[model samples]
Target: MPTPNPAALEFLLTRRSRPWRTLCLPAPDRDALHPLLTAAARTPDHGKLEPWRFIVLERPALDAMAQMVADRGGVTGVEPEKLSKSQAEYATSPLAVVVVAAPKPSEKIPQMEQHYSAGAVCLALLNAALAAGWGANWLSGWPSRDPEITAWLGLSETESIAGIIHIGTESAIPPDRPRPDLGKLTTWFTP
Candidate 1:
């Protein structure tokens, strides 16, 4: 017989990401965020590579990133509308954690698996924040993917942004979006 934690199961079933735009002030301070980061660090890593790191961005850093997006957008020929949206993503958020996928060289484990591990960390952080009573959203836009922007953020040549998780107080409860139908997506195999 297996023991089941009903509360944990319920939380998994009902978890929903709040929109970054809907998040307000009173974001978790460093002391409060420590546990969430610790929880995120517990993500499964194949071969014990630990190929990921986190960068917490406060208002000033975010503002600088916002300016960088605005300035670099013109050089990169990004459309105005897309540039504005990306800029707002950095400018408005009270606090965000950038999950960087820094893959380590491994003869046994592939780079793709390392990347997946970093992405898992992002989800873990997001879920942890939500479970801790904070509104959270995972975001990655053109700025996060752009080499120039990433370099400014101190990403090495081997590192890339897995996600930027924005965390803050919930201003509104967003209507739940449609979820995937497991029956249509799942396939049971029998021999």
Candidate 2:
């Protein structure tokens, strides 16, 4: 008989993403990170096109990304406050993964479907990190959507970042945020 996984389901139903700003030291290492990536890859793929990829942001990579943001601020007229926040997004990140939605050129595989797959991978990665007992949050600031920033991240025109997931141990557990009413949103058809 297949083993029932009630606990996993329960976790999914109530899982809440920790804020990136609340994360601190002791992020996942290579051995620890491999399994989480494997879990994320198990997300549903309509045609198995694997229309996404991950870029692990360790210390060195994080510094490089932060510098790029600074360079961008100079050219794009970003104000100091916003620029500081952009810098914090990378500077304070002990561990992060950039989820890129790389749409393949195929008439059969609609671009929307590829987009959906990419989004699924993002959630899967977030959930996997939480399940592994880590604090993780998905973030994408102006930089993520900026064309200039995309070029810096080495993404082709057809590629987009689903999210940038910041992960680490929790420095503080914030209060639970309110959720939308499921009953109000759902419709039952009992014909």
Cα lDDT, all candidates: 0.95, 0.91
How does model 2 score by TM-score?
0.93
Candidate 2 at 148: error in angstroms? 2.1
- The top-ranked prediction according to lDDT is 1
Model 1's alpha-carbon lDDT is 0.95
TM-score of each: 0.98, 0.93
Stretch of 10 with least lDDT, candidate 2: 145-154
RMSD of 2: 1.8
Model 1 off-target regions past 4 Å?
A: none
Range of the 10 consecutive residues with the lowest summed lDDT in candidate 1: 85-94
